[model samples]
Target: MATSRALAQAPPAPARRGQHPGIALTVIAATQLMVVLDITIVNIALPHIQQALNFNTTDLSWVINAYTLTFGGLLLLGGRTGDILGRRRVFIAGVLVFALASLLAGVAQSSAWLLAARSLQGLGGAIASPTALALIATNFREGPERNRAFGVFSAVAGAGGAIGLLLGGMLTSWLSWRWVFFVNVPIGIAIALLAPLYINESERHPGRFDLVGAFTATVGMVSLVFGFIRAAEHGWTDSVTLLSFSLAVVLLAAFVLNERRAPQPITPLHLLRDRNRSGAYGLMLCVAAAMFSIFFFVTLFVQDILGFSPLRAGFAFLPISVAIIAAAQFAARNQVRYGPKPFLVTGSLLVLGGVVWAAQTGITTTYVGGVLGPTLLFGLGMGSIFVPVMLTAVSHVAPHETGAATGMLNTTQQVGGSLGLSILVTVYGTASRNEARQQLGAFLHQATPQQLVEFRATGRLPAPYSSQVLVHGISSAFQMGLVFAALAVLIAVFVIKVRPAPAPVSPSGEGA
Candidate 1:
């Protein structure tokens, strides 16, 4: 912090190629790490948040969904916004917005308030993130400096989620869950303030803002997720649920139509025309759908079921970072030699094995017995898939459209996570509801007066009964994740064609 603080204190001047490269890299990389890590950092604090804000189990996914929905949905548009407006200006504005949103989230007194704040933070992130990457292109000339910059930025981005889990735990355990949000304030402000001094703006490109594309895509996804969640609570035929689904279809259809016509389309529909690229995106979507949900539910299981403290729960996932990095390096090194299909097929199989193993988890499962194998397998699988998918996505892309190709891959990840989590949470919510009903009579018979009182007030069964219900729900959700992992395996084995692609995979961190 002190070293970064000193960098900020230097007098304002645009960066010159050989001038304080470390300072510019630090500012840009820090901003990127902050944006990327926010996807998971809050997971450690979820239990605390639910208790404080009275968030019902079904409603709780919105804390994550809200951020991802806007960020993923608006991502392409954000990158284009940076192109039209100067990257540096958009980057600073985005950072400041993120800081403000963090402040609001920290002070949030209700579920709605926190959700709104989180969504705003997503908007800020979508705006800042693409520009942060673009700024690296402008600040460092293309060569070893640029490659090194990307590598450093990418490393921070890659490690951010694991870092978030640890940091979130420490903050929640030592200070409070609110500090998870509060901690972002100073860092974002520093980034916002220092960016102008060390980073230079890129030349503005002429482009039209794709307002229609962004609106339809974002709203459509929201409606679809809301429909699933509402179905969990109310049932499939519920009027609101049906209406949401109906609107989602209409809006999403219209979105695709708009993209085909919009002069500066947010998503160039043509990116999917290539078979290999499309397969890569599909693989990514399935992989993310499975992986993100595991992160969410497992965080809950470690804390609520296994009785791990927030800090301890955070550390429980540490090995995943190691596993993923090792496997990703292996894949990156060999992809040119062997091509992507073999790694893709093998990786997806690893994921399938992991998720199937995880689906068997129950009330009696221990961390060693239940968590370790799946976590490690999933980590390695993801690491292997990431580099290949990224390269395949951008393969055959025109030079001018390369950024859009990679951006789509990132968008697929966020959107896939949101959609997958929504579906899994829906399954969990319904399964838990039914399990609770089935166990109610038994629980009531043995319950103490105090336990009965607590149950009446909180609608939560104490200890053994609660654990039984949660295990039922979480296991059901993991089973659903298994289906996604299977789909990824199928996609990798049959759909991803053997193609020699020369595209350099952006050192982009695996999608959150």
Candidate 2:
């Protein structure tokens, strides 16, 4: 195994080019879009999945977490496999596996069965995503064409969450919730068949799997996330919670140590040495943490507090999709000219402002006044930051290692999102608990003995107290998000050094 830096700096003697670039681009990007969208597409259908499968309400979260954890954990390993084997071969294999898993999930008779199938789909996604991105880099020249492709890619990446909400709602409303999984069957089949015709295989390299490093990193991330989520559900002082955090620290430390010595490391430590890439990764993690919470809490706020139906709540997210697409297009077209650093700076600040604005929302707040403006700002900020960071992540990489580089980028986003969500949940849960305690104390002084007994029996506070508690919890979560966004701005200003993309190299090993 080679370090990402060496792999990126090296070039093939004769670049691999296939016929019909347009067709190739379509097949590759479409496949990538499908993989990205699957992350959130099933969220809306979770209640349905739970009801049908007879799952406990709390356990239903596993339906999503099982997929996310496996996919994010195995991403680097999958990318490394693509580099050692052929990307085309791995891509087709992933599609086949994903389709099979989708079929299994659609027809699952029990919660355990569904969870297993979802994990399988995630495994396939781990394989497919990085390869699809690398294939795009291989097919298109590095300039306007690639940038345009990346713009579309980034747009879809940002829009995929909103699309999933929309599509999940439609599928659950008109058809059965299972149709959400079933819908992927045809698309996966089409991409599997079409990809071979247009996309050429990447050249293979002899590499060893970094099993030690892989284990440490994956287990560490999973444990850390579990700790935070458990703390949110249970109290922070839970013994299991403390144990999980302890394990995470040890495992993560081991991962760093293993990477220092591994001959063929799964994640090349040198990649972290680049200031621009590091800045991009840090900022992406921060915003993504906030973004995941937004999707989670906003949906709850719309449906639970505002009395919107599920379908209506889903549709309400459309503005985010539209704003993200427009902003992504603009940023993709103009970033190289003006520089990525500026967009990163301004975009992060916008995200911070949006989080602050969103923190002000209450039960009495109107949708247009309280929700739409912040959502638009959030979408635009996401669009502006995502495109440039994606470009920076894979920019200047040599042809051979593009898959691994891009894989690391996608993995960071996934892991970061998961970890961030858990942390925000903890913050929200703490605030809610504090508010509930205060409300209980106040009610004790004012209420009759019978009313107090009724309140204790129901574990319910007064309406005003309940509303204030919910708002405080949500506001606390947003404040944490604001910190993440602010930290991103700091990284962009001080860490990343803006510079020009390297001049294109010709097929004959000379500068174009």
Candidate 3:
């Protein structure tokens, strides 16, 4: 009882007085941008990395999967760690670790070395990302200040993937692919140094870490993600794939049971009881699934079908980043007055439209006609969805559980992206093989004897037929992405019901 009393009497965090809060926010937002961009920054550099490290096509994917699996799997544990330890301390440590991993990755000589470094980078990201969000809750009061801060954070989250593509292109073209990793070193060091002088630490809670919950949840997610990735490469009926799925189910079930009883649960079961919050999670999951698949498939389409250079392909996404940032700012300003539901419903519909439009792309489609319009629509819709969804996810939550809530949000996004991409890849592979056979058969029937002889000698389809087959496969995958986006709209409209509260007034007698 005395311990409980002491805990209840813990002092609130120190407030910023003379210091400009903007400096602190910039540091936090920069860190978030770094963490989010790392997920995609390595994508454009993959072909180069594979060549340099002598990675086979089959094993090259591990460079990405290694990072995603560890990051998504360990996020809950990382969040809870911040709740027990101070967020600022953990945040700094994470940045230091991330910088070191980036250095190692830049200098890596072999496939094994790079994969190890990427996995370590994922660990650092898991530690830093949630703590970064939790820090906003700690540093800013629950008013316009917090809203504005979240606005910047949300914009960064939405735009980071596109920005990464551009940055990756520049680095890979002008310098080397290694610069993508090397670039992070300076940014991480700057953030770490500035953070101590600007950001205040949150109050720590005394609690036992739930080792059982952490282990089960992390392993479960890893298993699930591995199963999806393997199913894309091998048939779904493969024994190893079946085994991975089974282990995921068993371990995830164990995690749920453990969470229900743990003294200090990594994911508090009570948080899921809120209808709006649960709905937000579902909505974000579906939206992210489509969004990530768009980036993956569209990148391939432009590079392979349109025959774009990496630099040109990267510049193609610049409009998306700009659109998202602009829309996010607008949503952030107007959401308090109009509420989140309108934005959620409208934004999701736009996403549905965008993906559906993209599904019609063909071998002869022009960049301006086929890609630019759909991407702009997607960017606008995604930006609107992010701000409201983020606000609703943590609404009415207790201060201490802020980290856990935000961590869950980020996990849903990463896991959903992995699952969605795997599903799309499966669809693409099946469709491409089928289309190739059909095209080949049709060509054989129409080809001259000399053409047939050349085809037989080369053992490959002609350029036009090959491009058509590839485009057909890509279009089919976009159709699937369309379904995902439509589902997100339906979920947002029916499930989410949170209305925004009126803007808070500041101490200066003005609306914040």
TM-score of each: 0.85, 0.91, 0.94
lDDT of 3 by residue, 1-512 (tens): 45643543465445453286899889899998998888888889999999999999989988888888788887887888788777887788888888999999999999999999999998999999999988888888876677788889899989999998989888999999999999999999998988877888887887767889888988998888788778767878989999999999999999999999988899998999999999888888899889987798888888888888888889999999998898888888887788889989988998998899899999889899999999999999999989899889989989889889998998888888877887788888878888999999989888889888999899988888899899999998899898789889988889888777976787998987
lDDT of 2 by residue, 1-512 (tens): 35643543344333235667777777777777777778777888888887898999778988888888888888888888778776787888888888889999999999999999999998999899888877767677668787887888888888888888888888888899998899889999998888777787777676777889878988898999999989998887999999999999999999999989998888887888888887778888888888887787787778767777767878989999998899888988886577687788778888877888888877687779988888889998888888788888876666666777888888888898889888988999999899889987888889988888889899888777788788788878888888877887788778878765555678999976
**lDDT tens per residue, model 1, 215-302:** 9988998899788878888899999999999999999999999999988798888989888899888998899899876688888899
Better of 1 and 3 by lDDT: 3
Over 4 Å off, model 2: 1-19, 442-457, 462-464, 500-512
Ranking by TM-score: 3, 2, 1
List the candidate 1 regions with Cα displacement exceeding 4 Å.
1-15, 18-28, 50-60, 86-88, 109-112, 133-159, 193-203, 333-335, 440-462, 498-512
Ordering by lDDT: 3, 2, 1
**What are the RMSDs of all candidates, in order?**
6.9, 4.3, 3.1
Return whichever of 2 and 3 wins on lDDT.
3
Q: Relative to the unseen true structure, what is the C-alpha lDDT of residue 71 in candidate 3, on a scale of 0 to 100?
A: 84
The TM-score leader among the candidates is 3
Q: Pick the lDDT winner.
A: 3
